[model samples]
Every structure is written in structure tokens, then in C-alpha cells.
Target chain A: MSPQQPDANPSEKLSRYEPEVREAYARYRETGDVDAVQIVIIAMVREHLPKPSDAPITDEQKLVEDLGYDSLAVAEVVFAIEDTFGLRIETSEIMQISTVGSLKEFIAKKLGPKNE
Target chain B: MSEARVMPTDKKGRRRVVISGAGFITPIGNDWAGVASSLREGRHGFERVEFFGNPNVPVKVAGTVKDFVVESMNWRDWKWPARYEIARETLRGLAPHGVYAICAIDQAAEHAGLARGALANDDATGLYCASAGSAMMLHGHLGQMDRTRGERGNPMGVVSSISGTLNFNLAAHYKITGSVCGFVSACASGSHALGYACDDIRLGRLNRAVVVAGEELNAETLLPFAAMRALSPQSDPNVASRPFDTARDGFVGAGGAVALILEDAETAAARGARALAEIAGWGQAADGHSVAMSHPEGRGLANAMKRALSDAGADAGEIDYINAHGTSTPVGDRAEALAIKTVFDTNKKQPRISSTKALTGHPLSLAGAMETAFCVLAMNEGFIPGNPHLVNTDPVCEGLDLPRETLNERPRLVLNNSSGFGGSNVCHVLRAVG
Candidate 1:
């Protein structure tokens, strides 16, 4: 089969990532959650990461401990995330977030489907 | 019984400190006379200009110092060795002395007739400064570096860009051996620097200190603000900044520097130096909100104002004038107005408020000190400067008593407010002293 060819349609293709992506997509489709926190984090990391031609960033990569980001740079990232999501991230929460995966988890907690 | 008057000093018996002299480089005009006249005349300093590739950016007006020539002065007179060549060249004309922060400190020290090492040898003497960022030299160096070169792209970038090092450089230049440091709190930086210096004196940490606020305007930084649509684009190139006006669009970006010679009041009296004004109180607060936006309710700003009054032990009704941080932004102006209402609501006696940004433009880090000069001027002249080009008033700013035009009157107490990008707010209360 060609590289472009896939057995699933676009919707099914998107669902392969994780249930969170599907839920995010559903929220986006319903209320246009363009300002979602996860989306903002993705966008910020995408811009800062080394290009595909350079070293690729893994989801598990530590943003500061491994990537060598100083406090100011991290503050800039946090600012971008807050601006994107229109939500206030407490300073305490910011102190706890050190890795990409941790950030993703934080966003998922805030944005995941409501139990009610 | 005319007994010998005892000299007041710190624990080590150094002289006390107060503000003996002040200098301002602002948008309206450079010297005190010119700035005072312009403010009194209600002159608007904004004008249209082509900032970027965008032509229809709608607004174009800024308080620009068109005639400033920084290239004409001698470099050696500016105390420190020139670390950045471009900065050296920029400082040449404007100052007869050198352009470094130390040069400013030395000049203020010299004007006050103090000895060279007064700030250095006196443990009580310290250096406090507010700067937006280190000069653009670091930025230029970083830009030239090859990212491909990794960490070795530019060695000086790290050293020069550290926010605290600028004061170290100044201390080294002026031979100031006392405690030296710089504060970075965005736009309110200069005020915080002054306030911190005052706190040290009030606490008896230093017998005297030097406070300097320096702002350098470079295309590198202005371009970013222009891109962000944070500045006014008045096309006329003159009269572009209009603060507190209904048609006010945004702030006009400009830069300059100011320095204050703060000494203990008793020491100043002994030296027979004229005490310009009393540094009474300071208040600071964080909005804890968006980095680029202020809280809509202006809660943090109100708290800062209330705290400032409490710090001064003065009632809100006692404030005669206010030097507002009115950048003319839509949200910032409204938020500040709400804050003013909350603070001065009891007697319905609104103090006269005016935006000096109309004259000086927004000097970023240097704004606090530059506005401090205006407060002193207002207190001395007993007149409140007007918000230039303020024809129409916003409905939200309706109840607030803003100075529509220049008003001549003696203001006993003045409150100056400076708010920055990261939700940092600072308020200083200045009082006229005999």
C-alpha cells in the first residue's frame, strides 16, 4: 500500500492518537474549543522544538531538566499557554509542571469531558 | 544656647540621604523648563509614522524626542568603559558625559557635590536601578550568533543579558562599593527601583543611595511592540500620544533616562542641600492574571492604591493629584479608572489625575523615574498637567476626575502609579515638604 493510503477515514485516523484527542476534537467541533489548554501547549512546543531536520522531541522529553530551559523561557511558555486557553494557571501548579507529559496531563484534567 | 547641630548619619555615622537633585529625559522636552512649559500648555506629542510593513495600521501617533542627538557627546565622560559599541555611539550626543549607567550615577553625584567614592565606601550607600532589559547590545550579539554553533554562539550574550548585571556595571563604573542591584518588573520597573531605594533608607540600611532609571529605544524592541499592536501609530510623527481622551488609541513608545540623588534628610540638611520632596510611601501588588492583560475588575491595582495610602498613613481624600499609568490601551485605561474609583470612593472627592505619557510617551522601564520628575514638578508648581488631546471621555472613565486641560494649582500630595506587563503594580506617594 502507498504511504498515504490508510484503511481508516480522517476521523478514524485522528482517533488513533488517544481518547483525549477524540474528546478534544468533539469539544472543538461542538463549541469550537480553539482556546483549549492542550492545543495551546502543542502549539507552543511545536514552535520551540528543533525542526524535523534537527533532533525530534519526544512526548516524554523533560522541558526544563532535559531541554535546558531557564525560568524566563518557561514563563514565556506558560504565558503562551494561558493566553491560548483563557485560563489562569496558579503559580503553585506552574511550579509542579516540569515535563511535557506533566503539562499534557494538567491540560487533560482541566479540559476532559465533564462527569455530569 | 545655640548648641552645635549634630550630624545625622547611619550606624557607622555616614550622612543621611534625601533627593537632592533630579534630571529627566522625556518626550515633551529634555530639560525641566521645556517639559514644564509643554505640560502646562497641554501639548500633544503623538504623530503618524511608518513603523512596519503594514500601512493601514489605523493609529499613528507617538511622543517622540525628534531632536535628541546622542552622537554629539564625548564617550570618556560617560563613566564606564563602553561595553556595547552601538550604545556608546548612541550616547555620544545626548550626554556631555558617557552613556553608561555609572555615568548617570556619577553625574548625579557630581551635581549634588558629593565625593566620587561616597556611593562606594559608605556601606549604607547603595545603587538601585530600573531597566527594561539590558541594552540592545546583548540582543544584537545574540542575533549575530549562529544557533548552529550551539552554546558558543556568543559568549558575552549571557553575561550582558542578565538583568541584575547592569547595576553591577554601574557600580563598577562609578566605583560604588555599596549594595548594587537592578529590578525588572516591566513598565513599573523604575518606580519600583526608586521605592526599593526609599525603603532601604527608611529602614536605615544605607546612609545614601543612587537611583537611576534608563530606557533605550531601539528598532529591535519597538518592532516587536509594533507587531503586537501595542503602540499607537499616529502618522503625523508628532502629537501621536493622547492619554485619557475618548479618541485615545494607544501609547507612543519612547525612551530616555533619569537619575535621583537620594540622601538622608538630616544629612541633606547638614550639607545645606535643598530637599526636593519627601519620599513618603510605596505600594506594590501583582494581578496574578494574564501576562499581557490586566484583570478586568482592577482588583490588584485597587489594592495597590489602598496599600499606598495606608503606607503613607494618609487618607485617600488627602491626595491632591495623581500621575496615572495611562497607556491609553482600551482595557488598561478602564481597569485603572475602576481602580481609582474603588480607592477614592468615600468622600466622592476625586483627586486630579493626568497621564504624562501624553508628553513623554511610554519609556518602558524609565517611565517610573521620569514620571517621578513630573510629580516633583507638579508639587513645586502647584499645577496639574493636562492629558493632551483628550477631547472625548470614555463612559467608563466618566465619574473619574481627569484633568482635561492644564490646571494651575498647588498640589500638596501626589500619587504616582506605574503598572507593568506581568500584572505588577506599584504606587508611590510624594509629598511637598518645607
Candidate 2:
């Protein structure tokens, strides 16, 4: 059987870190870095990840399955990201977030002019 | 270094409890053996507080643990990545007291060689601890909220500062399923935990348990004591912790943690675990007197000692050494001294008395457990503790032979005493099974 995907896009109306998302987008456009957001997540995963992968960063890698980050670690990473960007991650957004690529995509949408 | 050796013959039904392993982090030393050596060498570790200073308070020096990093602790069962950065960030919110709690337990578990083979979760494995939760965890979280002007703050960090954090964190770490308790009986908290760990084994309730007690010294915690004039008036670190001396003012605040792994004699022997000193007996009592003052006649502490001796099936004259709950407060020291003299007559060669606090300053809840570990080391290594700042003896301490100088000898039986705030008193009679 095929695995269950998030039936509906949780980010459709998800608005938590409006201010931080806007600020991060402005910073990303200039520097291509999310002003410590990605760094914080990297730190959260690198702490206990058995072997920090050498592969190029991508969006499809599963947090738990590929990176070996536990649920607790994922929560911590999310918390740090929200704190760094000054936003709150809704449960719906959290349910849909399982990969680094997906989190960045979600952040991009959250930071769009219309979303802001 | 290893703990003192002992052998309790297999009993028919009743069980014997032994201190199998210990881990200590104190101002004087990082481990139990090192701390014992420092005591024997008449070295003190107190130094002026570097982080916080108040010109108004006479309490200047504090016994702080030097150069400690949680990354250095040995982790078992839990896998770690080579380029670990995530775990460090995730755990950055935990308090120093909580971190020390984990280190002490991990060290004890490793010292007992529990890492060699993993054991299944069962009711026999238990944890009992005494800790004053992390002030940093609390104040740090609150301060962040105030600084950021944020309405919501880290609630989990606040919970981690609660006293039960150690019980939850360590029990889950070791997979202990039995009775797990984190007690707070002030200074006697460690003794309370140790005594009851002994009880649980003796009653056949648990096969083995670890007892730990720890306190975190911080400027905020020290300020109240200074305000109450409960800390040493002297600004110098050398004479700050003069336990039973006439010049003694009050205790220099020091903080650290100690862990002692206890096992049933049969369980230890079957597991091929060597025994440290045997916990012969433990007696506890409460002084119905004032909360701030121990009994003037030292009746409460003396009663605890008498009961412990009786429980050990030994007499007063049999005890060769006594570890007094000497905090260096004028009244508290006098009360403990009076209690020792009352329990063991000074007419004979009074049991050589010493306060390990003189070296480590009082680690509050960690005092009793750390002292027990020190007693075991002193026995196996034959090192008597001496007061480096013993200039003049108080009137109450005159009759008692407070080993003013370290003796290069071993003691057979020892009594460890601890009295806390709220009128709590406890005594443990330890038999050096050398």
C-alpha cells in the first residue's frame, strides 16, 4: 500500500511567523542564507545524528528515516527555527514538515508577499 | 580510583547493602578518590566568586567546580554522530545542576560496569536522588522572556528546573522501572536518599539502586544566605570552612553532585561485583525544635546516632571514626559536637571526628552521600581527614578529639551524620569491611 501523504496542504492558511518569515525572505534574497534558521536546524540534527551525511543538501530526505532525527529532535529543531525566525509553527504545518526541503519550501510560501 | 572493598557473608534471607561505586564532583576534586587525597593533604578549593560580587556581603569565596563540560561525559546505549552539533543545541537549555546530575549517574553506572552488559527493565532497578533543582534553568528562562519582551517563554525549560527532573531524566536514561524518588530534605537530602536506598535493598524490595545528591551554587542562591548572615563572614577562602574551630563563622557555599551505586550483597556477589563499605545501619529522627536551630542539647542528632548504633548491633566504643555534619556555624557546630560527645563518651579515646565539609564546603543535599564516599575512600586508602584551619577549638569541641592532623591509618567502623534545615536529622553507621 502507498504511504499516506498530507491529504490537504496545511500551509494554505497557516500563518504563524509572519514577521520572521518576511525578515528571513529579505535576508535570503540578499545573502542566499536564512539568517541562522538553517544553521539552527543543522545544529539540532547534527547533535546526535550517527553520521552527518556528506551528500548535497536536498528537500526529499526524511528527517527520521534518512537523517535519524527522533521526534524529540524534530520538535527541538522546529522550535529553534521558529525562535530564530520569530514565528510559531502550527500543528498542521508541523504535520506536513518531515524533510529539510519541505521546511524551506513552507518557509518560502509563508514569507511570500501575499502570505505576509 | 575504586571504592573501598568489603565482603558480607551470604545471609539466609535478609540482604546486605554495599556502596559498590561512587562519583563525585566537588570544589576540591573531580572524583571521590581525588577529593579524599585533597582532604588528606590539607588542601582547600574555595576561591572568590568570579561571576557575581557584592561589596556589602562578607561571603566572598565559593567552592566552584572547575572546567566541566557535558560533551566529555561517556554516553552508552545512545548513539552519537561524529559531527554532532544538533544534540548540543537541543540540550543547551538544561541547567548545570541537571547536567551534573546526569554526569554523576552516568559515571556511577559506568564505574559499576553496568555498561558491559545491558539489563532488561525490571522492578529491581531503582533510583533515589536528592537535588536542589537548577536555578539557572528557572532564572535563565524568566530573564530571557523579560529581555525579549515576549509573552510566551520556554515552559519545558522551567519544568527541567523542578526537583523531579533528575528522577525523570536519569530513570529514563537507565531504564529503571522501580521506585524512583527525588527528595529535598535540605542538607540531609543525600543521607535520606542513601539511608532509604539501603532500606529498599535490605527489605528485598530492589536488587540494586543508585543514590545521588547534588546542589548548584549560584549567586542568586548565595545572596539569600548572605543576607541572613548564614554564610562565612571571612573574605578569605582558606579559613572559610572552619568546621569546629572557634574562629569559624559560617559555611562557605559550595555546590556539586555525588552518586553512589548500592547493591544487594547477594546480587553483587552473583554479578561478580566487588563490595565497597557495607551500610550496617541507618537511623533518622527530627528535632521538634525551631526550624533554624538544631536542638541546643543536641538531643535529636544524638538520638539518631544511638539508634543507628543499636541498629548496627554495635556499641559506641566500637566506632573508630565519625563524620560530623559540621557546617561551621557557631551554633550548628556546637550542637553537632555536643551530640557526638553525648553519644560516644569522650572519657576513652573518643572516635576520631572530622568534617569533610572543611574541604568541599557544604554541598547541601549532596553532603551526606559525598561524605559516605569519602569515608569509604579514607578506610580503603588509610587517610584521616584533618582541619587545615583548626586554629582554636570551641568549648563544646574540647572533649572530643577532632583529628586536627591527618592520620596515616585506617578506621574500622564509621558513623556519618547529616542534619538539614526543617529540623531533620539522619545518621548512617558504616562498617569498613576491609
Candidate 3:
């Protein structure tokens, strides 16, 4: 059996969502770009990405439980995320997408090619 | 936290708003006795200062409240923390029952022997306030915001800096949950606040209202006036504000707060409250010209005076005194004189005019209410207060009957004029109650 490669540090392993998220947030702030929806979803996940000092994070890492965000901070982040992606995350959906990976999947389903 | 108690009623059925008590925090003195003594002695409180830039600016001398101690009061003791400090200081020695606005609301309510929360649900009670720098405290909070922490600037900046919020906060604190608003017409702010409160009561919006006016000391506010060369630079600091003299350079910066409890004559009588003076009438107008300069003809100001007299149901000849808005600026003094000439020329007899700003540096928003307090005192005491530092009157002001010295004579009616930037003008007519 091939030797198992050590799992990359969570902070070192750039999520597929990182660059797209930063680019999307930058465009939204500068030009109110409507084309940055996919990028904003990626940014939202990156915002929850753990630092290298912290334990490795996963799609299953709960936003409040793992990231230690208060309701107010979470609400603020959600507000920013909504403004960026032009989508309304219902209160129920907010509860379900507590983990970074789950949120990404949820955003993908909401922003499917047909829904643009 | 419970509901405010209602005042007991007597069978007499008449209710009146009276000057049951009075207070003053002025440049000449902090208490009523001291202020009165200073006035009687012909004391002018103007002095020079270097606090603002352009020390060489010719405007020297102002009427500054002497020996003010900003540390005497705690900052957070009142609902509107900053203004409460100023208001409490203004009410330092006054009796508790007199109705007042701004910092004195609670004190005034308590002094009036009304139970706490007595005014809370009273729709017939309201509040009116006026000032320019009431919201100045927010600047400090904004400065404290940390950008590194991703902090947005304080969201409370605009609300705290708004000029009208001073009285609104006072009303809210006292549970005087009646009709509330503030007027902002530059220097005319105080007079307008009182005038508007009187209107609200007369129009039946409320049975009584508290009219309060105050100006706070702040660097941002002082810088603007200094930039305009409107402040005094007297070296002595105590002698910088001189109002009507030929050598007068400009006004000194001073802050003051005053409150008036206004009630209908019938109501005051029914309540057996001591009637201080009847608020006869008020007039307001605009210069319709430069925001910072008055019309040389004084036509708009003259009209306001005339309207106030008419509203008071008194002819111009019947007015015995005129409290002028003489800021000691060359143009302002002259424009006011011209306006006086226009108004009095049409009357059978011209009233004697004097400026309280001679004794109290221009308090801006508080000037009107402070002057109003002076008028109330003048009518009640039967005295025409002197123009303290005036030596040689301007040639343009020659024909006017200016008070050379304080005179102990009762006047039937007094007309107080306050004009401000943006052409805003207000005139109040007060008559002594029997």
C-alpha cells in the first residue's frame, strides 16, 4: 500500500473557495459585481477557515461550536455574505449550514447554473 | 420604573404655568443672586483668550462664566451624560420646583413638587429645546473607534451631535413623555425653543411644556467661530467679551443652560402656582441673505419685532424694553441698530434697548434662553440692566435709547430679539403678571 501522505495543514491547504472568495469580495466592494456570486460563497467558507495555530478544520466544523462566533458576529458575517451573493439564507437554512463544508454545498445548490 | 404619579387637584379648577422658581448659570455669575448683583453693579464679564487660533485677531474680550469647575459633577450621572453635566452645573443653587429644560428638567420637576414620573404619561406635557453643539460629544466617541479591530465608527455620532437632542433627552429622562422637538436657527435657537413651546401649549397640543436651551463648550465648535474671527482674544481671558462699545472687537465664547416652565394663565391660576410673567407673544423671520451676515437694512429683523408686538396684542409704544442680540461684531451691532430704528420709528415711542451679551459672552444657542431669563428678571425686579463695557456707542446706534447703566424701573412688556445664521430670527414679548 502506498504510504499515506500526511494530511495537509488546514491553514496550508488552500480551499477551492479561498481565491474565488477574496476576488469576489473585492469586486463586490469595488464595483458591486453581480458575477461574484460563486466567489462570495467561496469567501464565506474561507472566512470560517481556521488559522494554522488552531486545530485542522473540516466541512463538518460547526461555525459557532468550532469557530467560536457569537450570534451577533455570525449575523454580521451572514449579512455580508447575503449582500455579496444576492441570495437570502432563511433562518432554518442558517441553522443547518453550521459547518463550513455544509455551507459550501448549500450555496452550490442555491446558485446552480439554472438559478442565475 | 413604575408609572409617574399624578399631581393632586384643587377644586378651584384654574391651572397656570408660573415661574415658581428661577435659576441661572451665566458668565457674570452662576447663581441668581450673584447674577443679579453683578447686573446691579454694572459688571460686564468680557475677557480675552488665546484658546482659538489667530490670537492677533482684533476681536478681544468676552463675557465668560467665571471659575467654572468641570470636575464638580460626575459624567454619567444623567441620562444624556455630557449635557447633564452642563445642565446640572447651570442649576447649582436654584430651588428644586421651578420647571426647566435640558439639564434642569428633573431638578425643575422635583422642585415643582411633582412626583417622579408625574409627567411620563401626561400627553399635555411636552418639551422644546434649542442649541448648536448639543451633539458635540459624539466626536470623542468616533475618535475612539479602532480600525484595526474592524470597528465601524460609532453609530451614535449623528444622534449625539444633533442640537435638539439635548432637550429631548431631558424630557425622556424625566418621563416628560409629551410632544418633543428642538429648534436650530443658529443663535436664535433658545428663543425659538421657548417660543415654539409657548405655541404648542397655546395650540392645545399640551397643557404645559418645558423650554430649555444650552450650548456646550467643545474645541470643534470653538474652532469654527475662531476661524470666522468672531471670538475675542483678550489677553486677560476674563475681559475678552465686550458687546456694544465702539472699541468692542468681538464676542467671547461662553456656554449656558436655562429652562422655563410654561403653562396657560388659566391653568396656572387654577393650580395656585406663582405666576412669574405672561409670555405675551413671539415672532420669527429669516434674513434671506448670507448665512453668516445680517441684512444691513435689518428689514427682516424689524419685521420679526413688529410681528412679536402684534402677537402680544401690544403696540410697539407699549414695549418698555428691548433685549438686543448684540454680539459685538461690527456688522451685527449695526444691523441690529438699524432694525431697532425701523421698528421703533413706526411706533409712538421707542423702547429702551440693551444687550445681555455685554455681561455674558455669546452663549450661541443658550443666548436666547439666558436673555429670556434676564428679561423675566428685569420685568419682575423693575430694572433695566446696563450695557457693562459700552463706552462710546456706534454712530449708527446713536439715535437708539441704550441703557447707559442699570435702572430700577418696572417695565410693562419686554421684547427680546435673537437672530442667527441662515437668516433665522426670533422675537419674544414678555409681560409681568400681576
Which digits, one per residue and each the tens of the lDDT, describe model 2 over residues B284-395?
A: 8888997878898788899999988987878999998898899988989999998888888778768888897887888888889888888887887787787777789888
Instruction: Estimate, for each residue in B1-434, the C-alpha lDDT of model 1 and write its tens digit.
Output: 11223245434343333576675555676556777787888775544445455666553555555444432112223333232232321221122212534444555666567765666665667888887554455555465455323322232344344565457456655566658888888888888999888888877777677888876555544666777677775665444666666666667777666778887777677676667677767798889998878778787788888888887778999998999998877788888988888888735788899988876788888788878878887776668987765767888777778877788887888899989988999998887765
DockQ score for candidate 2: 0.12
Alpha-carbon error at A111 in model 1, in Å?
A: 64
10 residues in a row with least lDDT, candidate 1 chain B: B89-98
TM-score of structure candidate 3: 0.68
Give lDDT: candidate 3, residue A104.
68
Task: Give each candidate's interface RMSD in Å.
Answer: 13.6, 5.1, 17.3
The per-residue C-alpha lDDT of model 3 at residue B184 equals: 80
Alpha-carbon lDDT of model 2: 0.73
lDDT tens digits, residue span B274-383, model 3: 66677778898888988788898877798899888877778887889998999888788888888988888733566888887767778888888888878887776778
lDDT of candidate model 3 versus the reference: 0.64
**Best DockQ among the predictions, by candidate number:** 2
Model 3: residues >4 Å from true position, as ranges?
A1-116, B1-21, B46-103, B106-117, B134-136, B145-150, B154-159, B236-239, B346-348
Clashes of each: 47, 8, 33
